[model samples]
Target: MYPKVGSPKKVTMKWLDKAFAPLKDYLDAHHPENAKAIMGWMTYKGNFDDLYCYENRMTQGYIEFDRSGQLIRCSDNALDHEYELGYERIPVKTESIHPNVDRWIDRTVSAKKADIFREELRLFLQHVWGPMANYDFSDLKANYPLQGSGSPYCLYVYPSRFSKMIAFQFVGDEIVEKNCSLREYQKFEKSEREFMYQGWHLVTLIREFLAFEPDLSTTREVVRKGCEWADMRIDENTEFVLTAEARRMLEELEKEESKK
Candidate 1:
């Protein structure tokens, strides 16, 4: 049949280990490859009242084990959610088939895939942003404010100011690596119309270009083109308006040009 909560007891790591020990040993001995893949371990937590009270409420945790019986990753949600009754374990009905055992296996596989995705995304961000260890950033946006073409892209603005903005484009769900490009804000606006007509989903707009030390020449060229485009737009159209920050950046560019 199914397991039932027999009694409530204070949950602890020791209790979780004691409960999952048999399952861990079984998986390690029989499914060594799967155990090693998921980074197995056991965890537990107790439920207690906010006002210095203790309630004997707990829930079973998920665990994974390697062939050598080493722990990898484990977690329990007992203290996070109410379990109605408490934690209890059903005796393994069959050595080869059981719902509880199957559930943990599924969880382990899912966790492994999730970890892989996280690591990939982390490396992708680092490659695109390039050693962001020193930059102060704010006004972050991820998968929101859908573009007019109904596509969402990630954005990260630095220094909490509108002085510079970086837009990231993605192909499907994966980021396009080493593909940073820059275009004037006005030119980008014009291009968006073309993109919308052509059904293109990704676009990057560079309003103000910030120089990176030990710079990549290609990135600098793109930023330079953006600045040149903005300068042409300003000179050709008296009606074109610039944001306050944009205006300041343009003036600074003018001063730098005069010095050269």
Candidate 2:
């Protein structure tokens, strides 16, 4: 719940405007009804009488104007309308900064990177586990490489329907250690093959890094396959082996990923 009216805090119109600006044309074109409705409602007063008063109403005492601007004994319809319009205008801000913020940086991906990798992973999952977990592939599209969290490469893997969270972090550009709770895993019955395939797929994906450096000549080789980062644990279980070139690429990827 938001703070009550007159709570002595300012609503960030600038931030909200910036965040929601990108959606303006989109909203206007696709959702003109909502756009027109909000525009029409903006003319009315709202519950917060002080904020949404008419230009003339400013001369009158702030409280004198009902939220709706019409001077009834207990009417602030303008303010109420402003509140509603303000709420509707919110999405303009959220859609703007979302892309540059790397919201989709490290979410999920297609099963096919290379034919071999895809086939191998599919087989590994299908054969290894008797009952593979189901998931929404679209979630992969939202893979955000979040900072100040566990591991450099945080992946949202679904080990089971009930045990969906299997956050994995990279250890030294190689190993991808999982962040599953022992209790959660114990509660769910998974085949040995499922566990092995998950581990193998992660390693294989990491090892396939290319050099992603700005200047390919001076820095180590860079790979631009996938990018996301999290504050992952570095431990024995988190290590994987890569080609010397791939290792160099991954180390650089880690540094670049951190900057984002």
Candidate 3:
């Protein structure tokens, strides 16, 4: 067995909390309105007793608004498993990280909270890209994309007013289109979301970005298309994956600090 690294919660929390502080600090300072939650994960490097296990190295991959309410912070000990066509998924024995490194929380609640955050980014892209809006996401889907779960929230797009770039808010199955000027949209909703819906495993750090010139290429690529299944990957490499990048930057900082 691998050497114990404190408890799972303690070890994971130390890095997870600080993995995105600088970026988050900038966001809260400038764009408190667009404050966002960053979710990330890092697996043990290579095989056990190797680089990461010998000297902890952090990997970065994050998706904003992973789910509507609960953003699952996942850490998979990929060293123990392999992906084969017939490989059986080994069932974990406990909720503890030592025996079971995989962690996720799927709480059933309103997805509307994340729907608004999702729309904010969508609207921004729609306005800036204009004719080139679909360059990134053509449509928005609920974070938890399950049908008939009593969470009757559907993500529908608004026809562009191109006349004035405005962001609309959803209200009881209707869009509040009239008084939702872009300026007001940007200013309001200051309290839309936080990093933790309710913390578990000490994952409680937050971030918000005011301004950054982003390059939105290679966010998602069509990989291996079968009749009905296609593989899609999202990580810091993907476009608009800010949270992942945030954690990565923090880890880079940690590496630098350690050398000192």
Best prediction by lDDT: 1
CA lDDT, every model vs. true structure = 0.34, 0.30, 0.27
CA lDDT, candidate 2, residue 243? 98
Q: Rank the candidates by lDDT, best first.
A: 1, 2, 3
TM-score of 1: 0.22
**Model 3: residues >4 Å from true position, as ranges?**
1-3, 10-120, 123-140, 146-215, 220-260
Cα shift from native, residue 227, model 2 (Å): 27
lDDT of 2 by residue, 119-228 (tens): 22232222222122232233332222222222222222322222122332112221222122323232222322343434322222232121222222111111111112
Per-residue alpha-carbon lDDT of model 3 for 10-95, expressed as tens digits?
Answer: 22445433333433443466446644522111222222121122111232332111112122232343111222435333322222
Cα displacement (Å) at residue 212, model 1: 20
Candidate 2 wrong stretches, greater than 4 Å? 1-120, 134-156, 159-164, 167-260
Compare the candidates by TM-score and give the number of the best one.
1
RMSD score of candidate 1 (Å):
23.7
What TM-score do all the candidates reach, one by one? 0.22, 0.17, 0.20
Clashes of 3: 2
- How many steric overlaps are in each model, in order? 2, 44, 2
